[model samples]
Target chain A: MVDPTESPATGSSIRHEDHGDDLRTVRLAGRLDMLGMEPIALKFTSLTASHAQQVLVDLREVSFLASIGIRSIVSSARALESKGGRMALLVAPGSTVEATLTSTGISEVIPIHTEEAEALAGLGAAG
Target chain B: MAALTPADELHIQPDPETLRTASLWLAERCRQRSVPQELIDRLDLCLNEVLANLIDHAGPGVLEIPVELVLDPGDRRGGTPLSLRVRDGGAPFDPTAAPSPTAPTVLAETGIGGLGLVMVRRFCDEMHYRRVNDFNELTLLLAWPQETPDR
Candidate 1:
């Protein structure tokens, strides 16, 4: 498990948890806006896309989301897809984060799960 | 009970860094006016998108002028009507008229371009844009179901 400190300016934080068997989970919290994306973007990419490993981004604690943050997630997810890896997002059901992702139609490209078991199951099936 | 009551207004520079300030100010004003939390969240989201676009695409000329934000609350009726108006002296861009992008089925083909405007349109009930006296004035209007509890 890799724990990174939170950004004071944007109140965003990211941490990585290894579930063994080459599966990792990146838990993101706080706003995912223009400023919020700044602190965790590099770390998020390094943990998920750079290694080409299965990743489940947990966004249940995220209170706000914007298109810029969505762009970052899509960019990283695309990178992972290119490298033979898969990524899914875990968002709270009926949340603004979920609504935001749904509005962008990102669920078609990247699976968004409200349950962790479902998200992990989907990622596991991809391997 | 005028058609629209102007509750508050905020003036911000067209700077990316100042978007948060505008968002917080809007949220606080919404709360003070007993607006529902869900409506406040929607307003905050669209405000960020709109202000960010002004800073990014409106050019350096926008930096010289202040972006004006007004919160207009409608008469409490079937639902609470909330209208946010943003005015800036930048390039005349009408987000309301911008063509919405087709839904993407693949990650590689999905471009984040124009998605912000898509979000703004989705979150708000009505979007109106007009160029008046060399200023681009965009208004995002939304309302919540009356059953929603004020927070």
Candidate 2:
């Protein structure tokens, strides 16, 4: 379910999805540029880094992504991994978000799945 | 690098606050020209990275100077049809000369630094930097993917 609290200024929104058994999904919508990141950056970091063990960041709805947004996800994923947790991304196969992730070689470090079930399954594996 | 008339130029101070304004201006210009959506996205990404670098690293004194942006839809004859030229009084920093960071193989090795330049390189077809009349000018070019003729 989508969260009601959306950031209108930057047109970015972040919501949490609990799938039971320590699995959760953070759905991000709107552009992930400097403005887009402001409203969701802190919440995204807190949810993925401090709380969830196996988190899936669904970026299917993210229209635009800048390096700043990528930085947020990478750093949070690193933090989550340090705490014995794992983070994966769900990106539309041929979307701009996917292109950016792959171009930066983020797909190599963090598993990116086009399908939600596959993403969750990948997160379930031992890191 | 053709000079942009006053009508085609956007001027904004080097404040992070103006980033959105700059982006929207570029988007609006591209939409008016009917530039392809993919090219527009590429322009927006590269523009942000270039501006962010100027705002964060171009030193405090440079903030007083306004950054200038000019979008040029070059001849559609195929070789780099679209280009955006960004002019600022910031110190000379050539993004094309900057080394792209190696992609991290693991989260432990990942760092946020230099990723912006990396994206700038990947998205832009060509990057040209020049110090023009004391202003650091960067021209980022993007080309439409060639459509294969019926085989």
lDDT of 2 by residue, A5-124 (tens): 488877889898777767888999998887788878988888889954899999999998888899999999999988889998999988989999999999999989999988888777
Off by over 4 Å in 1: B1-5, B78-80, B147-151
Candidate 2 has an lDDT of 0.84
Candidate 1 residues B52-151, lDDT tens each?
Answer: 7776687756678988898887766745567899999988899888899989998889887888998999899899999999999998889756565669
Residue B32 of model 1 has an lDDT of: 76
Model 2: per-residue Cα lDDT over B5-83, one tens digit each: 2236898985656888888898998887667888888889999988888877888789889888888776444444687
Q: Which CAPRI level is candidate 2?
A: medium
Of the true interface contacts, what fraction does each candidate have? 0.82, 0.82
lDDT of 1 by residue, A1-127 (tens): 7787688878889987888867989999998888888878888888889866789999999999888888888999999989989999999999999999998899889998999998898887777
As for candidate 1, its clashing pairs are none
Query: Who wins the TM-score comparison?
Result: 1
